[model samples]
Target chain A: MELIIDRLTKQYKNKIAVDRISLTLNKGVYGLLGANGSGKTTLMRMLCGVLKPTSGEVKFNGIDVSQEEYRDSLGYLPQDFGYYPEFTAYEFLLYMASLKGLAKQSAKDKAKELLELVSLSDSAKKKIKTYSGGMKQRLGIAQAILNNPKILILDEPTAGLDPKERVRFRNLISQLGTDRIILLSTHIVSDIENIAGMILIMKDGQIVHKGGLDEIIKAIDGRVFECTVDAGEAGKLISMHTITNFRQENDKTFLRLICDKSPCENAISVKATLEDLYLYYFKEVNTDEKLF
Target chain B: MDNNIKRKLKSVFEAPMPAKKDDFLNQLDYPKASRLDFIKSQAGYIRKQVWVLSLLLFIGTLILMYYFEVSDSVIWILSSALPFISLVSIGEIFRSITYNMDELEMSCKHNFLEISLIRFGILGLANLAVLISLLILLAGKTDFGFFRLGLYLTTPYLLNCYGSIFAVNRLKNREIVYVCGVVTASVSILNALFTTQINDIYTDKYWSFWIISFIILAVFSYKEILKLIKKMEELKWSLSLTV
Candidate 1:
């Protein structure tokens, strides 16, 4: 069960959405972390065979991504997907099941089972437009796994989930990752911090970091620090380093930032987390904090 | 533990009768539907309004046929409206984009091209069925012979289809179908406007001309559908995404 992406590239009129990305994914959960418009969706679309890549190719085992045999083993949930509003959860799943080529009776059974698994069996008959954002997101997850796919690509799967729902989704995805390749993309660092076995960080249409959490965190491990200093000292530190977060308490300013060395004598080294690593690799700090 | 208990259990038909016995048998009869067979079943799942509207249009066509012999002008008007019967189906074939469900459907095992082809097939056949029914009814009722009667109606119908399909191929967004509607309606209106000029063709012997035109239109319509399929293979009905 290998998904091999070779030199994948996509270019739009004004920008290159994805450029020279190559990866070989196996049976595990891969968390694709990137800011918005960072090519996560574009890459996922190519893997799903929905959008043709401008260059290079994607293959599962040996079948090309564009082949029907390849698509038969693939499943995807887009960052944004639309369901027929009038359809009930049951109807929508059955519709998706039919598209996946499942027999009618079996499709019904699978829809029922998935709705139950997603904790939506009670509302199975309710119209989709009436469902909450979290409910709809869970529904999207259900549809993606309807085919028992070997390769499941979920783009921003937890975008609208509540805290409890996010936990539920994480657990469900962990269970699925044991035997299939599950790649989920999101900007929310916490979503993948616990469940994903591997992390892929994309920036400016290219993968700048990818590995296990610890492996990827090594890039900025000792560079992260937290310090509380007077407002005048904070201003000097802000100009010199990337401040991930800041807060003002009393006469002092507390800052969590990344830099080559401590900007102040009071700055203490802190263990870098996936969030710190994420924010580090995310947009460059604008240093917009005000301490006046 | 006893042979008698085992026999009794067998006689009782326990074990839940294989859980949905009828469905198991049905499943055997109907394997997982793919391609054409799956498309056949999808007909029921497509929005019911599509078929209902087509049926209503068919009924309206029947009503117009009822009043066909009122006068030459009425006959011309009925002939002009025949294409719209088929045009009602064009909007529905590309409805996934209109409703924004295309991305979800595009990733299916069938892919967007195959799925849209199925939709195209269903709507096209339905349009043909409506036209064929109208043609049959008019065959006995009209002053023109069967072939001659067909030429008048089919010419406009084919024009509408080709024009609508061209709009689908050349344009982008949800409004492509509306463009189809406008272009088809315009063709019909143009047909209606030049009734005297058209009647002149009938007065003079234009059988060779009509037959040749019919054959060319049919071939081009088929070719246009093929082109749309090829374009969709590359573009996947998603104009928002750059190819």
Candidate 2:
């Protein structure tokens, strides 16, 4: 199902959390990349009907979200998900399934199946309090998918995961997104770099960029460059260029920086990445306002 | 036989249902599952409070029985008060931990209507329990007139109980409820101590004063409840818009 968010805004007293922003999402994995407090979480919460918007509407296939029916196909994992500490992983998933209106036998069956899918079947009987951070995240993912929801919203789904578990979780989400609209919100760009079918970048409560991965990369097509400089000069180079990475070896520094055109004598042109585009847009937007 | 069991287990794990995207949208329109969904969702928290309150009440009952060295009359009081106190305290504790609408919105199965009803029902039952205990005490004296007085007092108790739960849920905070519970408990104890005088006053022309007071309190409570419900509806609407 398609999820459409139109002119959504959330205001808390004098501060605006989400400005009037609109976007339409189709079935696929979409990365919602933004800095912290950039309204990414607010937008996600609004989509799941957890937080009320100051104005505007969120709809699934033209059905307004305020209707309880719209929430049935929606699943969300908030950044700070609270679970009953005394419940076993199995029990917790079962409880979530019931909330989603699954039949008793179906909920039990789905809980067991999802536990296996997230690779937590071995510890399914263990209380949630005893779980490690990565394990809890895996359980969160499991519960989010227990109802086989059509629209899945996960906020920082890989925040505390180890590298290996992070990769596995991403793969699982990638598989799930083939038939559902998956909006993965994170401050970490790399989490969605390879998997996202579309990337929407948010800044100051507005979507600054939205398109496919290659299209976003194309936004800064000839901006990235790499060069070797003396170790002492590397700091000076960063002031003039968008230095993405720096490696020091044998008293020389290899710097991967970004500029509209080549800036150094020995600089080699390189293809732009999602990270380069994100930093470039955000940096440009910030600089235009004369704010460091 | 073991091999057959193992095969069955493997088959259970391997089975997949082809991921039928059933219409969750339609199901949301279905009648909400049960009022117990709220209690069940808060079961873990309720169990803890029940355990602690039950233990304390049990010990207090034993000590009172031993110290008074009275007949079945004393046992009767202990038996009545023990369960009533334990149940009310447990209900209060559950209400305290589970009143946050944000948390309930996240964890429970019911919609806002069902959730409010469950909260009101629990608080109502607790208040009813206290009223019943007072009635039983009057019965212990074989005073039907006093029993009738206690029954009459239930009208105010029920009104206050509903008002408190409604107020707490609308604010989505439990501190107010805690303060009210303490105040009401203290007042009830004081009232019980002066029951005979209060009953005498009720029989005289002062009965009209109590009736008028009850009417004023009920009106004020009704107004407060309506305001709270309006605020909650607004809150829910604004929240939906943001999403």
Q: Best candidate, TM-score-wise?
A: 1
User: TM-score of each candidate?
Assistant: 0.88, 0.76
Clashing pairs in 2: A46-B243, A51-B239, A52-B238, A52-B239, A52-B240, A52-B242, A53-B239, A53-B241, A53-B242
Runs off by more than 4 Å, candidate 1: A285-292, B1-31, B34-36, B61-71, B196-202, B205-220
lDDT of 2 at B82: 37
What is residue A175's positional error in candidate 2, in angstroms? 1.4
What lDDT, from 0 to 1, does candidate 2 have? 0.67
* Model 2 per-residue lDDT tens digits across residues B35-120: 35536654433345544554565566457545765333443343334333423543443342343334324422344444444554
Best by DockQ: 1
DockQ of each: 0.45, 0.19
Candidate 1: CAPRI quality band = acceptable
Clashes of 1: 0
Tens digits of lDDT, candidate 2, A203-229? 888998889888888877888999998
